[model samples]
Target: MVTYNTMIHGFCKKGDLYTARRVLDRMKDSKDCLPSTVTYTTLIDGYCKKGELEEAMKCMSEMNKQGCLPGLFTYNALIRGSFNKGDIKNAQKVFDEMTCKRDIITYNTMIHGFCNNGDNYAQKVFDEMTCKRDIITYNTMIHGFCKNGDNYAQKVFDEMTCNRNMITYNTMIHGLVKKGDLDTARRFGLNEG
Candidate 1:
């Protein structure tokens, strides 16, 4: 059963949500094994990745109807989907719904959503996080700002409390290169060293 679910996830990753849904339908009817949260979340993620939020929400509904609770991973996928759809409001709703289970990833996804939306709202979310901010949070904000042509990514990078990694440096460097700011990128690398 887990193998079948894994197959579904693989199908979803390939953007073949149709086959994934078919596999899921079969999994739902299986008498030997009930569908697990991981199973539903995987489908949701696949649909979300494909920017099929309607289908993603349907999967969320089905997951709930089947008595499986959506985890932070599930919500993160949904939030990301909403962001892709340019629906930060929906992402916030999902974030708010996650009162207890909101983790660093949750906040990071929200921050990324806001950054992608070009709203600079990630700052508010970042400032309000109860969970310890991690490197992904910093990287996402930096990437988002850089991606959106916001000049404040440097501030975000400077303010990061979490340990920086290659991805973080690479994202900043990528941003600087994209902005034709090689000198700053080199300077950033120098400052880090």
Candidate 2:
């Protein structure tokens, strides 16, 4: 069964949805081997990566129908898929559901999902996350703001100065240079001195 899982994962990684489904179907046919949550997750993740939200959502629903309780990771994958599809309402729904069974990974995934989707209200998610925001959270938000070309991204960079990590500094410096604000970058560099 583990071999089947690996095969499913390999197919998923290669984005061979057809072959992945075939493997999944074969697993279902075996009385001794039922597809586990991990197997389903790998398939859903592949669908999400391919921007096939409909397929992913259908798989999630089927997982539920098969009496498989999704773990936080499964929910996170769905939330990410919804976010990637720009379906903020569905993403928020999954996020709210995850809050009832809070986990650090779940929070981080939702935050990164919103940040990656470039949703303005991603800041609300950042503010409301109960877990400690790791460096990745800050970097994700910074990248999102930079991609959005928001002037207030400077304010975010200013706020990040309190943290003063290398990646934070690098992001701000790059952002400033991109905006042709070498003076501000030089001032920040001096401040770090």
In order, the Cα lDDT scores of the candidates are 0.85, 0.77
lDDT computed for candidate 2: 0.77
Candidate 1: deviation at residue 8, Å?
1.3
TM-score for candidate 2, residues paired by index:
0.78
What residue pairs clash in candidate 1, if any at all? none
Q: What stretches of model 1 exceed 4 Å from their correct place?
A: 142-158, 163-193
In the range 50-125, model 2's lDDT, one tens digit per residue, is 8998898888888878777778778878887887788888888877765247566666667677666777777887
- For all predictions, the C-alpha RMSD in Å is 3.6, 3.2
* lDDT, residue 6, model 1: 84
TM-score of every candidate relative to the true structure = 0.76, 0.78
Which ten-residue region of model 1 has the weakest summed lDDT?
184-193
TM-score of 1: 0.76
